[model samples]
Target: LIQTVKLRLFLLLLHWFHPYLLTTSSNSFPSFPLARERMKSQYVTNICLLILCLGAANNTPWPLLIFLASLLPLLHHTCRVPGGSAWRGVPAAPGPAGWPLLGCIPFMGPLAHRRLAELAASHGASRLMALTVGATRVVISSHPDTAREILCGSAFADRPPKEAARLLMFERAIGFSPSGEYWRHLRRVATGNLFCPRRIAAQEGLRQRVAGDMVRRVGYEMERKGSVELRGVLERGSLESMVGSLFGESSLGREREEELVGMVKEGYDLIGTFNWEDYFPMGGLLDFHGVGRRCKTLAEKVRSLVGEVIAERRRGGLHSHVGLGEDFLTALLTLPKEESLCDSDIVAVLWEMIFRGTDVVAILLEWIMARMALHPGVQAKAQQELSACLGGAQRAVRDSDIPKLPYLQAVVKEVLRLHPPGPLLSWARLAVRDVHVGKSLVPAGTTAMVNMWAITHDGSVWADPWAFRPERFLE
Candidate 1:
């Protein structure tokens, strides 16, 4: 009995001092009851030693204690996988070295876009960039071929996560949702109703009306103030157009419009800020930095407004045609029951549609105007085209005339290429399975972001990528 006790204590000491013993050779240890019993005894011994160590080290500094605690799990992980194929090193692309635990979090400061741009320029667009943000490993591809491969392939169809989707869409709307049956249905309905050629043609009249109002508003401001704030005017005009189209009439007065605009702006600003919870996962519980709280408040406000609009539409009758030929809301409500449409679903879809439609149009208009202002030559060319097409008509540019104006179309395309509304088309992925892009193996649950901004700016893909000359598309 004394010999057995001694043997057990010796085994315990070995287990505590060198845990890698078992992992070194799977075949070394016999699969017998005696070996199993010895293992259990060793574990107990190790636990006792751990307790004793903690008691003895009670006077250790708090930071040291925390550091040791953090290292304990890592030590166990490395030891348990000794000589295991799982621990084999894989070839990875080069990236900046980061500190332990925090890993590149400090590098990605408030100006992530500017910082990333600088990194791309310095590192070269063909190189793969990796950054460990909290526990997540983010790999950035600056190659247009890689970006195109990821975006166009079926391997990357699932959206990232709820937190990311919420930030991008400003609501738990279906647009940024995971690629599922619900998302498919939502996309089908939206494409059929809002993005189809026929629907776009119908919406053309609305766009022309809004654009005319915008031009008039800009002229009035320029005449009164001698110069117009282009961004502000475009923002309001775009918001009005979206609200009018979605509701078939403007429910938002000046105050409401301003409020909605502010909310949308806040949404955009919040999305750009790095939320601790987004990277740290459990960090959300503490509501660290109060970002989660702010997001919840904004979401609630938007939801309430959307709920009100949906209620009004339902009460007014599903197919109410009070001019404007029954807007999007009317079409949604009028869909057959067999189509599985619900009031909440309609509100969600409309919420996503309004924000996306308004924001993209506003940004695109601003970019186009800025580009035109920067290049007087391009501006003159556009003005000449406008004159030739409309004969100096003081009205909005019509959609019917867009096809006839090749230069204008080229300008739009160039702007889209240079400054896509979404720099990264929200991350997408296919269901858990191995996917290959060239030699790289994209494992299951891998998040894929099509870095459209990086792709468009790649020197390899475009000659003199920094130049904003729209003539590149003229051919």
Candidate 2:
């Protein structure tokens, strides 16, 4: 009885003060959103605890818990129009006055990159918008200059790792890893070993082989199934390209290659998933949809599989015929004392390289193919460039032939501009320190995202932005 009366008193007081606290004027409502979200979460937690305790003390039914849980969606993040005080202390950049707690998440559609671009155009000023997603405040940039200002700055060096990313050891890889000595070491390894001129030239044969194998597989499928499903074909070929580059050609047998491909798909799926926990400070405690668990499992599998391959290379067990230069595995084995990485760290680097490139190649190729199918004129021009470059001979396309075909290169560039695989650059950068992007100030701990899709299609930046004209590159 005492507890129930106390709860009733608290509720009465909350109801009385709720309207005054959520005022429309900047002077009344609190501007700092971190404090605001904390307070809101605290209220919900306290109310739930009080209700549960009240029900237990009085030996009432468990339906009270159910009722409270049901009301969570309706109770919080309501349509409270905050004033110009959305982004804490400073005057916020022009953007939407999102719901009370939910912010702009509900408005972002399935294709969030496209939606973010739309939001920037409609609600933003100077191609910049400040909005909240769950509890995390993000500053979205849709212009190339502003994006370059944000991305190229040393302040935006670190990344905001998602819950799954952290679970999957994001700190070890170059993709989401912290900016420090370790990241620099990885970069150095990439530059000196994997991407050197001689090594890239050696990989020309590997690319040619992968392309040929993909064509053969497509032909076989066309003869057998009477139609070509390019994604799967592209996926397998891309997987071979990535793994083969890292390890060696046909290093893994059919079974292991299949396993690796499946794992890559799973990893991509997990990374692409927008977990609500990723947005909030303590939201990981909720662990929606078992994403954390899945990521953990995937991380373990990646380490184990890649570790096995590393061990094989260390033992001189895996053979190679794909390149003139030593593969990434051999380079890792022979690294200088200063640049050496531990087994786990090495696996993480390899995982980033492998998983990052595989699906991207497939998606980009699919886009290029689709564009070619849509624009036969452009396709003919590209083919003419290729034929002229190859001297009208029926032979395999070599890497040396790439530089000679400017029209084909333009077609590829146009395809990339039209449809970027990782349109948001796969992940957002964390603003480590306060920085001014143009006239607006992006504070520390804010998530900064570059909408490349927006910049690539912006009318101000490009001539006839929506048209699929490969000749634009020729000019």
Candidate 3:
């Protein structure tokens, strides 16, 4: 009898609010007798539910639980505070009215990029589309202008990392670190130390060795197995190349190199896997795939390994910096007191370089190889350009030689256009403040993402976007 009375009261409130008071202000709606009963019923319902839950734990009948479960949507709507910003005023950028807790997560399958684009187009929000994934508001930029605005806007300058990234210590690194004094200092130090022309020239020998080693490995794989699987070879070589650049070539022993390669692969996998915690509140507790657990283990390993390296350099244990090309480690070690990073920060910065760089370099190269096979004519032209640049001489390619091969450069550019390594710009950018992306106002605390894949593939953006045309870039 009591349960039936509660059910009738719940239905009555739902019926009242169905059209009459959903949009009305508190001045009129709260004064209603049903509204007063709602407030009182809320507390009574909580106590009743708790007692019923304890009974259910003792194998209570399923009927009551089923009935209560059926009323969840009503409960969720009733519990929401009135006059939410998402509903009031101009209204949040129009999108789907997702389910109670899951939001639009259940709708966006594996092809979330395509799905988001479709959703945007369907809602006539082709430029900036808004949606929620597990109650987290996310605005996606589907057009080039909108994407550019979000990318360049100061309000969206903060690159809030996904849950996996944070658990894996990405927040401390340059790539995902919040915009601030530390990030600026970190960027300056890294750029000055590692990316300068002088440093590039200095690392020529390291690049040559890594390339030659990769070619030899490919040949060996072919000879032994009659074919080569380049994924493992490329992944390992790319990681080692990044490590060599950071720690000075050959600073890490062979065993350590292999260990670090394994760890980078772990990071790459974790970063690629979608974690529920990134979207949903309290989602961290649901580690169904052990993503968080693995990320923690990886973080500890990276810190320990990178810390070991920094310690060795400090103790003068490595093959001396005697002939070294002054890697990032050396520059960081010699940083002025004002710019000096803590040991943990140093490890994060170094690990981040390798972790982010390897997979991207490897993947880009893989796409180039695929494109080369698909377009033999383009490959032939690229080869001819290379041959001309080398002037019939047997030698390795140099950074300076790049200017002499415009066609080859175009080939690389076109490949990037067609197959960008980071389809969503690697990760989503966060709105530090309410920002207007085109005409849409992305509220503060919302996540913003650029759909680079959509932009790159759009018919309006490129003439025959599906066609692989290197010559278009050359023009």
Candidate 4:
């Protein structure tokens, strides 16, 4: 009778402790298959549970002890697991180690450009240096070769994930669209109509004519007053020239031109302002933040302006033809109303062309004038070239004359190298598939960017990278 009582007590203990043992074993196993085989026999778990309980009864504290023993492996594994591996198991480029969750947010202050340069200098070349500004990971690649590979390679051709695309494209702009058939088609159309050799040559005449007008306007201002507001004058003249050339008529009055210029400036200003929501997806919900509100407002204003232009063109009943100099609006409106080329398509393309073209030209002109003012030697050389080419026959220089003037061309190239309008060259592709870049594995969905600024300044590629030497072109 005493033996039967002991056996029943042992069975009760097994029943109580069997589940805990099984649970512990499953948790401890590295893989599912190992856990399954161990669990296949209930009798084995029962025997182990009985032995454990007997040990507990002997004042060994086996239950509590066993629980802790089961947990240690998991704890150790959790603590020892390394963070995400850098490209090809290469140690992440040495940058300031960031705080947990926040990650490098505190370091990026007002001047991102200076801060980035400083970081790159501190971190050795080809090392992975990363900063999480808000939620976006700003990975710095100090290698010009890497930058070139990413930009030229077909694998990385998509835009970075950002709010700018949605706002700028209105779900249709080609600049922000994914690189695919649609983008290819849009690019072909734009190149054929606007950027083709013939079209560009034709536009050169207009550009030269405008440049002449600009010089005259500056001279007038100089005559009126030794120092005039160059910014305002240049801004107005550039926009008017672009609009006039596009429409084949100067429909934009002073008030309208100023309004458009203000809108465009605001749009660009908004782009420069850091928006935390863009990098951190969840943060975007805070529309109260000025960036989100400003983007929406600017987008609406630009769209309305574009819509009005489209409406005017439609009302005029213009027909599209190749090589006819029909103007951008007329040429777009005249495209056969096919599924591929619709009115909305025309509007989006035209809007992008005007905004991008006008902004680039205006910025380039500003840089050229600023540089000329700063470097008297360069300005003198350029003036000499201009005089030699034009023979002082006219105050204005022609586009035809630009090719002949090597110094002028060199000046433009130098300005572009020194102050590239888009320093980063826009966000490039997210790797859609694994690509081996050197020893590093560019994982799928990794954001890529071409650091044009860095490329232009690479010491190996350019002599005296920092100096504003237009004579580099002569070499």
Candidate 5:
């Protein structure tokens, strides 16, 4: 029944996007609401029926009752605040009105972030705006001041505790974990133990070794094929770097690496894909889109893989290789049992770190390289700067030499400005309480997102914003 319902929604989406995809003629009126303005009536009617059906299946009749009880008032345009008119005094920041209940969901295509950036750009000097998505209201902050108010402050620290994220991530991973004692503890442990300066310095030799391997692989490919696939090389290098840091370098071979990478990528895609279940709470129990089912399967696989590694480490103290002695697992194991985290917690932390770090580095590097390849003048300038810094030395540039290569650093920064891997920085942040960002008052429970892409591209904020001019950073 859930699958059938999902198919209906899928068809609705298809009709919403491309009417031609269905067998129906373009001239025919839509079976559902054709005018987006009046979709609220149909949206509520269908959702009520859906809730009743879902409630019957689960033998819990209260869900349908509860939804209708709350929805009736909204249908009558009752004031959210008692004794006051709707949204009185507290103004909703400017944005598209969208459809009645569905809000802007139908209009947001695959390039949603870019679309948002376009919206932000049109607002001139205004850095904050509001968007209604389904039942949720989202606040988009496109300026540094507004972003800092939401990010640096504690009022908007928590993430939206979505069902898919909680179920798959167990709400234990640092990224998904709510803002509380546990999250703070995890952050402290991660920063102090995993990424401390001392620990980083200790891994210098290991990083150098990985760099050597990447250089050799690139050289071999160039010599044999007369060219090299940069992305593949970078991806492998990134994976190896993270894997080597987590477990011993020998723990993952090329075959295992390829297999695990595929699994990880699929897992990421499934988790990231928009699930209607997330927006509407009733869909959580219904499994309407099978997103929850897929997440459950993927979660099991991830747990099995992470658990095996932990079990192996417990059985054998550390790898025979001295280089593996400083791996994160080894460090985790060394902490006093009373003070240390549980095995489950450790696994979540390590997996989250590895999952996030690997792809990001590769993506950023690929973007930088691609930009360099496109702009010969900028590339030449960076090379000249590197040559001046290195003084014609044949040896590879070391970490210590980075500060000396200003032009190269500028190029990297420019690439980051032009093409951030996560265009929407800190993707989704939920307000725990009513918060004031600049002049706007973001009510409690509002989902806020920083449009870093918008900030980076704003013509007022940046001179010649669209151009890929690395030299702009130098001045």
Candidate 6:
């Protein structure tokens, strides 16, 4: 009776202090699981106390002994058996030890990619190694061949569900969507209309105009202030090209362009920033990092802006074109009536193209410029090649000049080889079925990551892998 009274008092105390113990914001995600877990804990405690009372009332040790014995198997499984060992016939790849439920999240630092590469290298595994990050089982491919083996097939093409992909991107973005008819349709539409060779060639004038404007802007800034910032110019030019291709140059005013660029930058940073909610299912409820909240806000802003543009285009009956040629938005809008997409899907495609296309070009240009600044000899060689290709007539480099400028192209290739923008090529691919990736047995449901960084930096694969030697390609 005394023990029961004490238990009741404890429960009352817990209920009274619950609000004080767990503080949550009004806009926070639901925390019903928190209450559920607490209730479960209390119920277990009550059951244990009742069992003790029964034992004492009967004056028998047998009941208590039997109950303790019953728990042995459960305890043994939780302690002795690791999470991954449950899958029979699947070979366990070498990886770090993990605590129950938590997995290897505690060990992962800020530089997770670099840390993963280090772990993979240290294990001296054949080609692949597995690590449990939070609840997710991930396999990192340490070699190019292993990466190809895993990624080459459709079996590993499905993307794992990520909070950012859902909340920030609305799960409509082609990059995050699962492999299906819709994905295939999106890819087909993109490749056939937006990225075909003929369409790309037609955008040459648009690219030249953007580049020329950037050059003029840089000259004005330098002449006025004796200095110029490349980031603003590069980002603006790249943003214009992508936006013009999507909504056309006439569709966006200066204000809209700035707004789109700002939102795009925020979206990029938010997506790139890791959110714990993805790994920990219940982690979103707390959202201590505020990643989810920020993403939600950014997604709302982007959706609203993109929706307005689409609405305006529809209302105005604008046949928006790029460089006086057909545009991607026009193609999407002009799709057959039978092949109609909802407004949300169309916005997603447009947003994704704008987000991806702008960042890639701008970031690559920044990287190449940085490399040139660091290696003047290489820059001089590229400049000489450009002059030779242009015949020293003070003419801007053109699309036609790209093929003829071997040394210039070589430098770009070397940069790409050394510093691939997507170092983790095709990140977060999920295995749909059991597959063997270069002697490594990757079971279905395993999250596979092709560590391109590890592959590129492997000394065995490349001679003097650390050196930034662009001339290596020339040789």
TM-score of 6: 0.79
Q: Model 4, residue 419: displacement in angstroms?
A: 1.4
Clash number by candidate, in order: 2, 1, 0, 2, 0, 0
Q: What's every prediction's RMSD, in angstroms?
A: 11.8, 7.7, 8.9, 14.0, 10.4, 11.1
lDDT per model vs. reference: 0.63, 0.75, 0.75, 0.62, 0.71, 0.72
* Alpha-carbon TM-score of each model against the true structure: 0.76, 0.82, 0.81, 0.75, 0.78, 0.79
Candidates sorted by lDDT, best first: 2, 3, 6, 5, 1, 4
Which numbered prediction scores highest in TM-score against the true structure? Answer: 2
lDDT of 4 by residue, 362-382 (tens): 778889999999999999999
Indicate the TM-score of model 4.
0.75
Among the numbered candidates, top lDDT falls to 2
Q: What is the Å distance of residue 424 in model 1 from its true position?
A: 3.3
Quality of model 4 by C-alpha lDDT: 0.62
TM-score of 1: 0.76
Ranking by TM-score: 2, 3, 6, 5, 1, 4
Query: How would you encode candidate 6's per-residue C-alpha lDDT over 81-165 as one tens digit per residue?
Result: 2223332245667654343355556545545656667666555653877766666777878787877877788879788767766
lDDT of 3 by residue, 213-309 (tens): 9999999999999988888888888987888889887789999988988887888788778678887677888878899999988899888888988
Model 2: lowest-lDDT 10 consecutive positions: 77-86
How does model 5 score by TM-score? 0.78
Give lDDT: candidate 1, residue 140. Answer: 56
Error at 201, model 2, angstroms: 0.3
Cα lDDT tens digits for candidate 1, 1-475: 9558545654554555554322323355643322332253344345545744583457545345334533543444342311121212533334433333444466556544445545545444344454455555455566766666666777677665546347445443675666767788877777766667776666776777777888889899989999998888888888888877777756556776787888778877776667767666686775655666787788778778777877876676764453335677776776667766776677667767766677778889999988998999998998888889998787667777887788888888888888876775344344245566545555555555555677687787889877887789885
